[model samples]
Target: MYDDRERDTGTGRLITGLTWTLLLFALWLWGRGLTGVPHGTDGPATGDLFALTPAQAARLPRPAEPLGSALPQRVDIPQLGVQAPVVSRGLDARGAVDPPPFDQPGVVGWYGAGTAPGAKGAALLVGHVDTVTRPAVFYKLSTLKPGNTVRVVRSDGRVAQFTIDDVSVLPRAGFDARQAYGPRRAGRAELRLITCGGTFDRASSSYTANVVVSAYLTGTTR
Candidate 1:
């Protein structure tokens, strides 16, 4: 989520395109930095970090095999009570993934040039944490814990079921695009739901940190 003076705080600074071979090098050289969200309002002031205990991790379901490429239609996070439409998004002139339009705060933007949801790679999804006047689709994203489920309905008549494995609030100062957007395990289908977190800096019109929720494919349904 880039700055929208009249709408959302600075958010959505995800990597653009699937040219990981070269983008990885570029990000390593100069990590991407994102702006912060607002503070003390109806939105989250900072992201909540949740780590899984060894036993809890062991209790999670095993990873499911990856599916063929298909466009994501909607994303549902049961724990957050979120059911949002997914829209295709491309990179801006600055080479960063553009977020959903400010007017469509409830919509989630998917990186069209990258891996599709349910595919064998990390599919990037971003949303606004809050608008100037109220909380948006991802306002409660940080509250999600490991093992929560995320379901993505794809255009190919399949629903990809993912189990949350990691939730972290990464600082913009040294944002690691590869680590954040890359698949946790090779050949696994991964998903990242991202939004703004941390204190918003009025001067910079951005949030100090980004909330990144990582999940891996665990099941599938029609």
Candidate 2:
């Protein structure tokens, strides 16, 4: 006697398991690549590494005369119902954004070396979907769509709102280093939200692609 229902359930479970295994594998690969540790590393090089067009550079935030001491401390997306605190830090030697506290699953991380949110240029914020054990802050970031709103709370008590323009997924190796980190339209502020995605590679322990969400300033609150 062939049991169709039993067979279908078994097949479904197999597919789900397979998907998880593949995701783990992709993540492994991504982690391995980031750990190569560049030799003769210069501590945080300045200037435009992307050779941005003059027009693009004009849109980005201008460098502060003394560089502001305060940075963003929180992020809120009313549409997604996400309101996570943000931690400020520089990149690690491995060229990967550092992970935040595992317990704080909804926190956003700001790249302190680059433009601050609300500044003329683009600001970068990164979060992890998972940290080996559990899902982290940005697990739902992929759900954001165009026209969604994201708000940033800076340490100085200023709030900035950005409207989502686009979301994209790029292979880890194919990520646009310039566009992702470069300046934005003249006099307009921009933000980038990044996280791991695509299939996970267990052998490498990292995601195959990075999910990026780009947004532009739409409003501000004093």
lDDT of each: 0.77, 0.61
TM-score of candidate 2 relative to the true fold: 0.66
Query: What's the distance in Å from true for residue 53, model 2?
Result: 24
Model 1 RMSD in Å is: 9.0
Off by over 4 Å in 2: 1-70
lDDT for position 203 in model 2: 71
lDDT of model 2 at position 120:
59
What does candidate 2's lDDT look like per residue over 1-222, in tens digits?
A: 112212348785586456434433433343334321111211112222123456753564432222123478889988777788888755455544555655665777776655678665677787776665566667666667666778898777778878776666656664445555454455567888877655666676555666677878766676
